[model samples]
Structures are given as C-alpha cells and as structure tokens.
Target: MSETPITISNLNDYIFCPASIYFHSLDYYTDTLTYQDSYQINGTAAHNAVDSSTYSDNKNILQSISVYSERYNLFGKIDLFDTDNHILTERKKKVNKIYEGYIFQVYAQYFGLTEMGYRVHKIRIYSMDDNKMYPIALPGENPDMLKKFEVLIKNMNKFELETFTQENIKKCSHCIYESLCSFSRLKE
Candidate 1:
C-alpha cells in the first residue's frame, strides 16, 4: 500500500477521471497552472462559511473538521457534522444528481468519524444551489454500494499513470487538468 493516504476529496475526481488526479499532483505554481472556472468559483463561494469555520458557537455543529480513517487510509475535511443528531453532511455548490462519488465521500467521512468513536446516525449531501438535502444509506445498510466503494479504493491504490485511460471522453472537457493530460479527448 502507498504510504500517502488517499485524499477523501479526490474520491470524486477519481470517479470523473483517474488521470486527472495524477496530473493534479504534478508540481506547478498554483497561480500559473490552476484554473478556477465558474463552477469552481461557485463551489468556493458556497464553502466559504464552512471553510472559514465561522459558524455559530453551537457545540453540536462542527464545520470544516478534518477526519481520517486509518482502516481505509483516507483523510479529508468534512463540511459539517451535527453532533446533536449524529448526522454528517457534505455541502456542494449544486447537486443535480446524487452521484456515487458523492456517496463515497460521505461514507469515507462516516467511517473516519465512526472509527474515531463518533456515532454517525446518517449521512447526507446538501445542495446549496437548491437548498436540498439528499440522504444516503449507511454502508452496512447498502452492501452493493459499499462493495463498489471498496472496489474504487482498491483501484485507486493500484493507480498507474501509464496504464490509465479516459473512459468518458465527455469528462475531459470539464476537467481542469485537460490541458495537461495526454489522454484528453478535447482537441487543441
């Protein structure tokens, strides 16, 4: 297994295109190489409150807290954890569809917190755009989805840039690393 833990946030990107993660790791000056399109900008804006950790002084509400799962070797900051209700929520700028990637992210957070001795009653995806909440089943309650998530993690552990291929060409146009990726389907 790789010494570096898999980033929880990168789980979504991996589903989009594994190659994107490899290109993203390349050393490049942030200002010169990174592109912040409207979607990214909107996402940042949506996360500003949580990112700044400026939520009300309610002890039951935890925002922008880091979580790690030694068992899964995954780590990342979760958007919110409502201690009073034991609900973990991941906030997205907009959530048109409850993608498998999104579920995987919340599951990782759930597993991390549970391993750390926190009781997680539920997991959800909150869409800032539509002001909606989409609840997800717990890992034990959804064995099929859990199996898929496990397979994804296994694939990530074995990821190799040389052997990776872009299965969904349409994703390339939306990928930030398309300009740097040799497998990008977008025409220059």
Candidate 2:
C-alpha cells in the first residue's frame, strides 16, 4: 500500500495515540459519538465562517491560508495569516494549555513559510473562547519533533505499533474513531 501523507492534523492524533495513525491509514474509521459535542460543533461553524468569508484585502488579516514545507514533508492550512505583519495566527476554540503538538504544528507552519520564502516574523495562538492571543516562542528547527513524525509515518506504513495504549481515557472518549480503533484502551 502507498504511504499516507504526513499532515499537520496527524500531530494531534500522534499526541493522542500513535496507533491512531495506523487506523487512519487503513481507512478503518467509525462514527464515534464525540461529534455531538456542542463546543466542537460551534468550533466547526466558526472555522467554516472564517474560511469562507470574503473579507477585503485589509492588509492585516488573511484567513484560511495554505502552507507547506517540503523540508519536513508536511503541510496545513493556517487559520489566520497576517500579511502586513508576517504573523501567522492559529485559532483554537479553546485551550487550557499549549500542548506540545500545538507547538509543533505552529512551528512547522513557521518553518514552512520560511522555506517558501515568506518572512514569517511571529506565530501566535488565538483562543476564540478567551478572545486572547498567546504568542508562541519559535524554535528554528525541531529535528526531534520531525523525527517523531518520521517514526510515526514509518510505523503507520509498516503496520508497526510502538505502543497500543491510549494517552488518556478522556482523550480516547473524545475520539470519533474510538469504536473502530482496536488499540483504544478505553474500558467498556
């Protein structure tokens, strides 16, 4: 089988559970109940609105911009790309803490933009819930995180799992593929 493309979203699943990559690569998805959350629903709508909005070229905010990095073999859509200031703002519905995966994703975008010849000056995470912007400290090159992505990609392609445990029951509970994910350690 062909290898699956490593995406920015995979970082989230990898942080949650490496085995999830395997399931996702196989296309063995199940409609678990997590989508019913109102928060997620609202977040989707908000993202859609931002993505589809026909905002004039205000020379400040650009929404739903595509970014890619050939060096890291990853790509993703940035939520808000500030053109005038060269600041990439990623929007989240809510975040209690800035997780490693989030940092990696943002930094990857920064690297990608740099590789693409855009002078990305800063990166920030804008919490929609708090209506606040939290600046992210950019680390120029994250070989460790890139290596982790490589390992996960290799594991997924070879059907090799380093572990089969859920990161946490709470995370597994919120997973839409919980029903189909065999490695899900969520107890019945």
Candidate 3:
C-alpha cells in the first residue's frame, strides 16, 4: 500500500458508489447541480454539534476526534468515543436498516483507536433521528466480516476510476453525483 492513508468515511461512500468518490475528488461546485436534498441537509445538521466539538464538556466523552490506523492505512474523525466505558460510536442522522457500510465505518474507528493504544470494548451506531443505540460485535467475533473489511481496505488502497463501476442501478438513481458520474445508469 502507498504511504497515503484512505479516509475512513470514504469506505461508506465506496460502498454506495465508487464513481461518487471520483466526482468528489473533482471538487465541483455549481448552484443548481450541487443541490442538497432533505437527507443531506438533515445529516449535516445532525453533525453540527460533533463537528463543532461542543457535543459534550465531559473529558470521558470525546467527540469529533481524529483517529488513524497505520496498520490499516486508514484515517478519519470519529463521532464519539467514551473512554470511561470503552465504547466507540458512529452517529447517523437516521437509519432504516443497519447496512454493511455502517458496520465497516465503526469497525474502522475501532481498529484505529485500538491501534493507537485505546481500549474499545464495544462498537455502536447511534441514530439521531430515533435516538437509539445499536451495538456491533467486535471484529474478532465476526471473522468473515473482518476479512471483507480487510479486502475493502486493500481494494481502496489501489482504487482506479477506470475499473470501478457502480452496478446497482437503484443506488445510481438516488446518488447525489448521478448527473456527474459517467458510469451512472440513471436516465432522466
């Protein structure tokens, strides 16, 4: 793998559509094309407290902290880390179902923190919309999923736009970069 680390959040985006990452790298800006849907708007709004690093004043509850795993070559900001209880959480605006992407995100954070000498006994996802917490099993408990996550990291390290294709038409139709992606199958 190259020295450059992969952003942990991009793992979720990669799961959504690899082409979106290519467009994101372009840094496009247009008033009409860059529209924010309700989901996007709500997600941003939900992250405000963590983004501002004011979610909590307690030292045990860390929010919006950067974490990195040199072993996995991954780096990203974690939403919350409870030192007192050794819980790592990734909060979402809402969740209809617990997707693999969500699991991978928190798993990445868990690995990053543990690699950095932190004891993350539990991993979780918090839905701001319903105000519920869902716990995830540790990677060791799920060897198959951990192997898949390892493969994902390896693939991301050598990602190529030409070879990457988003095969899910349903996902393409709802993607924010649908209009911008050349591989997008969404038809107006």
What is the C-alpha local distance difference test score of each model?
A: 0.81, 0.64, 0.80
Measured by lDDT, the strongest candidate is: 1
Give the worst 10-residue stretch by lDDT in candidate 3.
36-45
Query: What C-alpha lDDT, on a 0 to 100 scale, does residue 50 get in candidate 1?
Result: 85
TM-score, prediction 3:
0.88
lDDT for 92 in candidate 3 is: 82
Q: List, residue by residue over 1-188, the lDDT tens digit for candidate 3.
A: 97888887788777777777666555335445566444323345556788987788999998888899988999988889999999998888887778888889889999889998999999988888899889999999999999999999888878888776666798876777777677987663
Give stretches of model 2 more than 4 Å off: 1-4, 21-46, 54-60, 141-170
Worst 10 residues of 2 by lDDT: 34-43
After superposing all C-alphas onto the true structure, candidate 1 shows an RMSD in angstroms of 2.5
Task: Give the CA lDDT, 0 to 100, for residue 74 in model 1.
Answer: 96
Sort by TM-score, best first: 3, 1, 2
Name model 1 segments beyond 4 Å from true: 23-29, 32-43
lDDT (Cα, tens digit) per residue for candidate 2, span 98-186: 76666766776776678878788888877778787788765645567657655654554454475455657776787666777666668
TM-score of each: 0.88, 0.71, 0.88
Residue-level lDDT for 79 in candidate 1:
79
